[model samples]
Target: MIRVLIVEDEPLIAEAHRTYVQRVTGFVPVGIAHSGRAAMRAVADAAAYGTPIDLVLMDLGLPDTSGLEVAAALTGVTPSPDVIAITSARDVAMVRTAVAHGVVLYLLKPFTFAAFRDKLDHYREFRASLPSNNDTTVSQHEIDRALSALRTTDLRASTPKGVAPQTLDEISRAVRAAPEGVTAADTATNVGVSRITAWRYLEKLAEDGLVTRRSDYGRAGRPKTRYLWKTKHAN
Candidate 1:
């Protein structure tokens, strides 16, 4: 099994990642670190314990230090684990920098479970394509085949029907702006859509693992559903 380490600052998000990692076959979540220092320590401890991490799901924004810095530091580790950047940052420069620091894959924020699984599956295929023995040398064609396994198709194709990307963006922004949480009615008012329409988008977000659903029981009548943006960072 592939030992994995998750480096995310947010407790809820980190837990979600851990759960996702557990669901995938042949992958085990060995540790979770909320900061760069903690991540480095975890890697070191795991290595010392004779179960080194094989993959790292790194979040770019950390409370202590930038994830890129941690990724760079990890390069010095013997039998370095492959890093896959998971972040909300979309800046081209950041992407280039992450690649330079040896990030094998880049997964943007607000992704669905399907997308997340696809990434892990691709990484597994990439590893399978590689030479199993350390002393084995691979040819150019073999190298190309291994790397090709990591390539992902366009994500837009996977989006559910009837969900407009623009409207989804607007709804997501409204939810993120509300620190406490937002109901479908509130989202409808903020995004200039009907309550049902807002609810549909909110449900989609929840299904995608971008936002969380909660029940508001303080009200007099039946409990109302509230949607809380999962990540601290805005996508």
Candidate 2:
């Protein structure tokens, strides 16, 4: 299995990344770090213990320092782990800098399970295409094939059938606006939809990993199910 380390400042987001990593067949989340320093310590400790991490799912907005700085520092360590940047930043200059700092892949925020899985799967393919022996010299065709494995098609058009993108956007906005979480009824009122309609969309969001579901038992009678947006995103 490929060992992975999750580095995100937010506890919930870090846990979500850990869960997502575990869901992939060949990946295992070995640790989670909430800061750049913690991430460096975890990587060093893993190396010291003789079980070095193979990959890092790095979040760019680290509290202690920029995630790009962390990535650059990580490269100085022997047998550095590959980084796949997971962030909300879309600045072209940031992307260029991340590439210079050795980020193998870039995944934007508010992504679904399908999109996340696509990236991991592509990385696996890329790794598989590489030569197993360190001393082996690769040909031009072999190099091309390995690099091609990292390419991914656009997944923005991949929403499930019967779900309108406009309505999904509205539901996402409503959930993000409510940091405390929202019930289907609350979402319905906010989005101008029926309770049942809101429930269906919320379920789809939960299934896609964009939102999390929990039971609210404080109220009388049956517990109400609430859905929360997984991360904070710009409107």
Structure candidate 2, residue pairs in collision: none
Backbone clashes under 3 angstroms, per model:
0, 0
Q: What is the total number of backbone clashes in candidate 2?
A: 0
lDDT of 1 at 151: 75
lDDT of 1 by residue, 87-194 (tens): 999999999999999999999998877668768877887898888676899999789887877875443554688888667767876886698999999999999999
**lDDT of all predictions:** 0.87, 0.86
Please, what are the lDDT tens digits per residue for candidate 2 over residues 1-235?
A: 9899999999999999999999877899999999999999999989888898889999999999999999999997766899999999999999999999999999999998766876887788778888866579999978888877776544246577888866776787688668899999999999999999999999988877768999999857999999997642111
Q: Give all candidate RMSDs, comma-separated.
A: 13.2, 12.7
Model 2 worst lDDT run, 10 consecutive residues: 226-235
